[model samples]
Target: MFDRFIDYVAKVAPDKIAIRSFEGSITFAAMNRDINRLAHALLDVIDNSSEIVAVNYKQVHIHWMLLMALSRIGVASASVSSNSEIAEKEIAILQPDAIISDTLFDIDTAAKIHVLDLNWYDQAMKRFKPDPIYTLYEPDRIVRVSIAAGTSFMRHRIDYTASMIESSVIRMITQEKISWSLMSEIPRYPTLLPTLAFGSFHGFLCYLSIWSIGGTIIMADREQYFAAIAMLSPDLMVISPAQLQLIAENLPEDIPRQDHLRLIVVAGNFPNGLRHFVQQRLTKNLNVTYATSEAGVIASINIDQINHDDTAGWIMPWIDVQVVDDQDHPLTYGEIGNIRIKSPNIVQKFFQNVQDTHKQFKNGWFYPGDLGILNEEGLLRLIGRVDELYNFGGDKFYANKIDAVICSIEGIKDAALFSMPDNDGIQQPWLAIVRGGNFDIDQIARLLEKEFYNLPDVSVLWVNSIPRDEEGHVLRNHLEKLAMQYIETI
Candidate 1:
């Protein structure tokens, strides 16, 4: 798959920029040569053993090159980062045959496994020959494996083969009309919206689609979120909903040539506040997509529709989506139920997790654990997660409603609400909020009282900031701890 795109680009546009990072940029021809040399050097490391390797690298080029090299040898590649103890534990769980990283890890160095640092590997690969042999690998062999972030140890892994990768890119081009022509005078550059550690399936698909179209990938230090976008006048950008919040917060009053951005592709849950910000501030056309790590791209809704409708967008062409009840029977339109998707882009299996594999992957349908309604307009209006529903005195409600209401308030930046037992053992709602300004707790409580009558007693705590994972998801457990500590004092 890599060869098909990289080779074609190298022949037609050798000087075209393929990847640009903080350190420097590399051309298509040079990137292809480096991938070949790296693959040759990896042969010695593997020593004829067919094994999946875990690559934890800081550089964007290294991540792409390593994956390309591994694919050439028919070995699967899993990208991990040394971000947290949870991430480190997940990598250890993989027990990769070889751990190729820029920094040292705490895993046991078994004799069979090859552990090489980037500094040493870089020097070693320099002396190797650049002869790419893409024919050695079968298309059905697993090419990439990524885990769902924010799941902690439940880090469910999704395996993708070369054919899946190729098909996903094709879907992007045909379904979304995201294409680039060699005849066009304008340059098509795709800026990376997420870090390699997150390894979001949508982000990876965007990366592959951009490369397939011979477009340049612009990436920078993950820490320099706003600065990177300002520096690189990217034609297209793929960002997550969480990252969009960061962009909205950091946007300057006036940016030079900011209107040059043509498209902004967002994946994952779309919050109302984010939609409002994007619609009012950013002039670029917004494309909101609904996809899971298990399934590549399920559905999407573009700007005007997204701004107007409270749905995840229309289902993608050729995808079979069903809103089913507990019995797996399909529900009528406008009925809220569990969402199940069947598509060629769905992962074949969750590596090494038999229980999850059986529970989630059933009858060729992958249950995404989301509760939503398919409206008459054919749009999926996501209500909440089925598993996250909590009961208070036999009344069931999703915390997302609490979050949505609080976040929608004028003086609230972010908030999280979860059910917890009080001193009386009655389940009550507890809220933690990051103040956007001088928010009045009594006024907010009064507003919520109008929505849900007899709302359970809620304890509110004002915090400087809400803790979130790298993906921008609120860390519920961490917030619970803080709430507990405050409750103890009260």
Candidate 2:
């Protein structure tokens, strides 16, 4: 479906730089040739069947090329990190026909399956030089399978169709006004620089969106991101709130301002005050995007909304968003309910899990496990997750609301609020605060009492930092375990 876009750029501007990494830059023409060679070489290792192929390589530069090659041949692809143990577990569940990586594993089942080391794969592809002709994949075929994070034992898969990938590109062009088409007056395409994991949906989409416009992607590790940005001067960037806070705290005053930069923050409810701080210091515009692995890029609010309004954003043109009740009945404006979505860009189903498919995908609408409300103007205000809504002695409340309020307090750098079971198996509200300077626990307790008059059995912990994943999501289960250990020790 997107073969035309890549081929067009290779034809029109063969010399244009497509990717820029620490190693070097590769042009559109060269990328096309390399992908063609890789696609042809892949045929020898994997069969023509629709079975998925798992790739766990250390060299991040080869991921995009491998994905394009997989798409070209009509085979679904799943990527895990270079950790052999995690790869072995995923291989057991996914049962991929081929496993491509930088090193070999010791799993007995892998002996029968084709295992192509990336170094060997590249050397072999070098043997097949010129473009190899191959049949294109159908639009409705599954091309990519993505895994969800925060699961220590189980890995859940979300399958993306070829049509869905194409639609995602179209949505980026139409909604973001980011493109290099002749109709656009903008002379240069945007360069995306992300510090997230390579296997993440956000990271993959960032690379794909840039490639769709024949733009550049600068690869950098989290520690090297700030230093690399100074040299690369990327026009587009995506980050988590944790990264934003890191920049706000440590960034030097003498760093050059990137006038062309457009920064996007994903996966959190960014307070308006912090949004202003980031825009003034880091970039010209700040976009807070609310989305999920199942439904990609649901909505994005720009600097105007970030400054003036309290909203995630109005629904994007690609999605049909609704606030529905438990019975799947549509709710009226300003009524808080489950946020359900219908979009062509969303995944059709889980790869092999029937229970998760039925739970998440229902009646053609994907419930992203979020609670929200839509105003009369169609603006979306996401409440906490329905599952995260805890009951304190018959009073229901969202933990994120408490977390946001506590984070707003003076001298509080970060906060995590959740319920933990006590000795009697009764769950109680607990607050963990990361202090920036001198913090008054008494004053915070008074504030909480003022907010909830009957609130009792509330405990507070002052920690240096909160436990979080690579994507900056709070690791609640890990935190709960730590809290239990702390309580027992005390």
Candidate 3:
């Protein structure tokens, strides 16, 4: 697994920093040693009884080390979060052969499941001599299990073989234009801050990409988002769109925008009218990307290459993207339909989730269930989800059609139009908005009337912020709940 890459990086830049947290930091050389020592310690205590090991903790280095250690011993690993709202449910579904977590947390599991406290692994790894006796690679064996980032909790397990993960990592390096060289002085992303959630798939990929080249991964979870940026001076920062909004809105006036940053990659869509402000406040190198848990990197476009608003950049050369009709046939260019992605490394099916696998994975293509359009030139534009279609007496259209028009109104920071059933059980349109200081609620009605066709009377639901998942998808259920509460209050 990572041991070989670590060994290679150690050979080149052993002295360079590898992982950094508030507690401490480790160099590539020392990290390699520690991983090997931990692998040997795990080798003694671990057996084939547990099919998959779940690594659950906030200790960044420890979590990472445990993952790589399990990989070295040819045992698959799943990154489980102790703080996940459905931690117990996740553990039950995973039914992990074993769980490695902090002793302070109580994660009840079956008596058959091995639960190794991190303190014990730490002590044992320190005392035992290290032997780098690890299987270098297993192409067919599953090496990692990443939970899908859909269906609210995104609990559906997605499995990856060693080859699939390697391919995905290489694709990331290629798409991100990561420079690789033997000369250590070139400084390849020396210090990095990734704003994606720690245990998420993209976050794991971010860490691996940085460590593949022996760069510093700053686990600054304890500090405020922008505060960490000021204190660490990271050369590269990887943020999701939601995190981008938080930093853009909350950053202090005194702190200067990061113009000197080597790169700033947004892992998901950049909302309409956001690029200009983000470029002015954050780094100008805002690399926009679109990816899925089933499908790997679908498309990526550098900020400089962008030519349109609300675009998901260009589809990857290796991937085939098509907007399809209801029957799963392809739709012509510029027409919005379900986005079906086909790539070499796309996951075959969900792990232990038969219903989802049947619905999503078919004939090497993964139907992500999101509405989107592909232009003739291969540019992708994402619309809302299939379940979000507004049914106006059986004439259905994606709700984002109205949203895209509504966002044209000035001072409207963010807006999502949702379909909610009225007291009579008829579906009605409801607008949830996060207004900027200069926005006018009345203006939304006026502008929407002019641009929209036969638009229904939209009830307004004012919210301080639009609730979204880490992936930047609007949490429509939460929005509807807020809307319901607002109706009750008024």
Candidate 4:
């Protein structure tokens, strides 16, 4: 599969830079040689068909090359960023046969296996080059396992089989060509700014896809993302909606060529207010994408299709989407229900949690626990999480909806809404806002009163920062704990 991929790239543009990181750039030929050397080193450590291995690498290019090498060698690679001490704890629990590291790190374990240092591997590569051989692999075999950024001991397995990888490469190549074609049609360049970290699937996959097609991927830290926009003057960029909101709120008037950016691909939880803010501020459309760690990209809306503030778009050809109710009964069009999908791309099961694995799959469909409505137009609009909704005075309200409305306010930086028990021991809705100034609580209360009259008991609390998990999801449990403390103090 990799040979085929390399052949395709070689035919297109082999001498072009395939991987660029903070360290240096690697051409296609050099990257191929590196993967071959790594594969040989991996073979020396373990026989073929090794299920688990610890890949300790920080450079983005190394991660991609390692993934390809593992796929070719028929090994299930588990990658943990060097920053993760907790990941080491989980690695001890899994007890893989081999551990590959870019640098020597402290990992207290009993697994006696080869620890291939990347620096040493690179140094050795200068004097050795192996003959290229066509390697065959079982397309259905598991190739990669990615630990989730959620609670400890709960890992999300990513099984990138050969067939899945092939499909992914084809789709990405097609998308890249289409994006470039569109750029030519419009005569504009699309600049990519991906958020780093092992947990970011899109950030990892998109960068690899762009590199495979000889495109540039600009790497920047969280702060550097905004700084680059101010100084580097990119024509197009991709960012999460939350980051876009932060950029819009904190942008300076002297931002260089701010309007030059033609497109912004905003993914993850697409807050409605942030979409509106982007449209209003830049006078450009916001492209929202619905994607997941398990499944690559389910659906996406282009800038031209951002009408009615609805998630109306085509589902990716590779995805099989179904709307089902609480009882797992499939719903017809125009029905509002839970969204489930069946795709070879999604992980068949979680790494170690059998109970979650069973619960996540129903009738061979991966239930993501999101409630959505599929309209007659075949557009899917995610409402909220099935477990995140609350009933107030017999009226159902999604926490995300209230969050979007509160975050739409000019002064509010971030907001989260959840239910809490009142003095009467009845569940009441509460809104927490992370703001910069003295916000008028009474005025905000009146605004909520006018908009959400069904929510009779609404409380407001100012917080320094909204707690977020490593994957950028709002930690509702932490917010609930903080809300209880604020209630007691008041």
Best by lDDT: 3
Q: Judged by TM-score relative to the true structure, which candidate is superior, 2 or 4? A: 2
Q: Which tens-of-lDDT digit does each residue in 8-89 have in candidate 1? A: 7887888988887666788989988887888888787775565678777776667778888887777777777655465466
Listed in order, each prediction's TM-score against the native is 0.89, 0.89, 0.88, 0.82
lDDT of 3 by residue, 123-211 (tens): 96778776666585768778777777553335577777878878877787776663222223334455787777655677678778777
lDDT of 2 by residue, 1-490 (tens): 3445666688888998888877778888888888788887877777666368777777676766776787667677877767778667666666666767667667745423455666667686678765655556577776767776312313576667777777776676665573222232342577788766656666677777777787888877767777777887777777877777787788778776655677777754676667767777777666777767777778877656553333677677778999999899999998989888997656757767787778778988988777888888767887767666778888887777778778878889899887798779888888888898877767788788788666666887767789876566666666677788888898
Model 3 scores a TM of 0.88
RMSD to native for every prediction? 3.4, 3.4, 3.5, 4.1
Error of 1 at 424 (Å): 5.9
> Which regions of candidate 1 are displaced past 4 Å?
1-4, 108-115, 149-153, 178-198, 263-268, 307-309, 423-426, 469-472, 485-490
Between candidates 1 and 3, the one scoring higher on lDDT is: 3
Better of 1 and 2 by lDDT: 2
lDDT of 4 by residue, 1-490 (tens): 4444543564467676554444555666766666776666556666754577767777655666666676556676666656759657657655566767766667677654455666666755664455454566678765555554322224455545667656665675564444334333432223455653543455556655555555555555666766666655445565665566667777666654355565545344665566666766653634556766666667766666655444635576677888987788889887878888877656666666677777777677887777787766557777767766778889988877777777766677778887788779888877778886656656667777777887867776678888765445567777789988886896
Each prediction's number of clashing residue pairs: 0, 0, 1, 0
**lDDT-sorted candidate list, best first:** 3, 2, 1, 4
How much is 364 displaced in model 1, in angstroms?
1.6
Q: How many backbone clashes does candidate 4 have?
A: 0
